[model samples]
Every structure is written in C-alpha cells, then in structure tokens.
Target: MEDNKVDSKKKRLNIVSAIIYIPMFLGMIQFFFDENYRNDGLGWLLLLTFWVIRNIDQAIRDWWDKKQKSVLFDLLLAAVVLVFLIIRGMEYFSS
Candidate 1:
C-alpha cells in the first residue's frame, strides 16, 4: 500500500510537470527553426513562463544542496534571459 501511494504521487507530479512544460517545449522548437520566432507573443509568453519555472526549480535545488556557486550561476543565467526578454520586448513593441 505504501509503495502504491508513492507511485501515485509520482504519477501526479509527472502529469503536472508535463502540463507546465509542453508549451515551452513547443515554443523552443519553433524558435530553433525560425529566426523571427521571438516576435510572436505566444512564444514570449511561453519562454517567460519557462524561465521563471526553471529558475525557481534551480533555486530550490541549490538551497537544498547548500551550493553557493551553482546558485550564483543560476542567478547569472536568469539575469541574462531576463535582459534578453526585456530588450526583445522593447524592440518588438518599438517597431
């Protein structure tokens, strides 16, 4: 019974993650093929959602491991993505 419950919990978590990640995966695939993909509002929305989710997940893992260097790297990467998103947003609207 305990093993069954654990399996159920894992199954639920997998389903939730799939719901969250599928759209981001689609957007990334599109962006890889099309240079102009960033201009699309749907792509931006999915990317931002992905960035936020990914950073939060990394932050939690880093905290659990008490890894300062990894945390700093994650922060740096998040900042770069944030900057890219902001710059592209401005250009997207300006034009």
Candidate 2:
C-alpha cells in the first residue's frame, strides 16, 4: 500500500508537470517572437498565465517530494531564473 501510494504520487506529478511545463515552455519561447508585447496586452497575459501555471506546477511537485520548505530548491530555481534573465538582458543589449 505504501509503495502504491508513492508510485501513484510520482505518476501524478509527471502528468501534471507535462500538462503545465509543455505550454509554459512554449509560451516563454513565444515571448521572444512576440512584438505585441511592445503595445498590446495579449502577450503579457500569456506570459503571466504561463508563469503562474509553471510555478504552481513546481510547487505541487515540491510538495509531493516533501521539499516544500527546502531552501536549496528555491535557491536553485532563483539562480536559473537569474541566469536566464542575465542572458536575455545581454542579448537585448547586443541587439
């Protein structure tokens, strides 16, 4: 019974991650191609929606892993975001 519970939890997390991460990842890519972000609102809406879904999915996974309070994961996630932002900033400056 305990083993089944763990397996089920893992399966659910995988399914949820797929449902959230796939679209969120694509939305992030779309932001780069979107010029509407300059004047229109749809791009911003998409960004906000996808970001929320992505973070929610991460939170769910973290909870399932019993690491909801872990600082290491938060720090690593922050580092990745910081690096991505730095890289994007450099690209913008170069262009």
Candidate 3:
C-alpha cells in the first residue's frame, strides 16, 4: 500500500514535470531561431515559471516530509525564485 502510494505520487510529479518541460523545450527551439529578448521572451518566461513551480513544490514536499533543514533550503531557493520571478514579471509586463 505504501509502495503504491509512493509510486502514484512519483507518477503525478512526473506528469507535472512533463507539463512544464514540454513547453520549455518548445521555447528553447523558438529561442534559438530568434535569439531576441527585447520585445519578446516567451522562453525566459517559461523557464522562470518552471523554476518557481519546482521550488514551491519542493518546499511543500519537504515540509510534509518533516525535513526541517531541507525545507529551509527549499525556502531559500524559493526566495531566489521569487526575486527573479518579480524582476522578469515587471520586465515582461512593462514592455
């Protein structure tokens, strides 16, 4: 039962990862052709979105696992992601 639960959780996480990364792969392809970020940067947006989502997910998982030290590390990572997310958001929206 426990093993099944773990497998199911892993499968869900894998699905989430694929959902995030498939577009990232597409974005990378688009990035290589144009290589211009001044006016448009969907790739950068996608990358940032993936980072923040992963950070938050990891933080939540660590908290649930009762791993205090790991959770702190995850929080620190989340802080970094938040800073970048804010900066990129402003740039994306303002332009």
Candidate 4:
C-alpha cells in the first residue's frame, strides 16, 4: 500500500538520523570522561566511527534526494570526512 511505502521511508530516515546522532552523543560523553576511561584510543575510535556514519548517511541522502546538494549538506559531509581522515592519520601514527 502507499501507506506502507511512506512508513518504510520514515523508518529509513529515522535509522539514518540515529546512525549519526547516537554514537556521536555517546562519544561526546566518553570524551569528557577520558581520565576515568583511561583509553584515548577507544574514545577516538568511537568518534571516528560516528563521523563515518554521518558521512555515509550524507552520501545516502545525496544519492536519494535531488536537492541534497545544499551548502549545509556539503559542509556536514566535508566535516565528517575530515574528522574520519584525521582519526585515520592519528591511528596510523600512533601504532
């Protein structure tokens, strides 16, 4: 039914939002408690994964929506990509 299709689309959008928001929120918490956690690598890894998720979501949106080429979307995608790249560079240098 048409309703089913609409529900499916909403579900997909919710999933994409969660993928970007959840880990980032958790990572922000873990970052603030670095001393207690005592593992900077783990925190960084979580944050990096968060960035990757956002980037992937942005890519999906770009492909699915014709108007996804907005400046805000571009900035978000670029920022996420840059964060992940920095994380990769840090991991490479650290190990």
Question: Model 3 segments beyond 4 Å from truth?
Answer: 35-40, 60-66
Better of 1 and 3 by lDDT: 3
lDDT of 2 by residue, 5-45 (tens): 98898898789778877886676667757766542233444
**Candidate 3 residue lDDT tens string, 1-95:** 99789778877987887898787767756774674755246566667766777777787777767799998997888789789878988888887
Against the reference, the lDDT scores of all candidates come to: 0.72, 0.63, 0.76, 0.68
Best candidate according to TM-score: 3
Model 3 TM-score? 0.68
Give the worst 10-residue stretch by lDDT in candidate 2: 37-46
- Each prediction's TM-score versus the true structure: 0.55, 0.47, 0.68, 0.52
Better of 3 and 4 by TM-score: 3
Which ranking of candidates, highest lDDT first? 3, 1, 4, 2
Which residue pairs in candidate 1 collide? none
State each candidate's clash count.
0, 0, 0, 0
lDDT of 1 by residue, 1-95 (tens): 98788668667766776787887788666865676754466467457658866875676557656898888788788878877777777776777
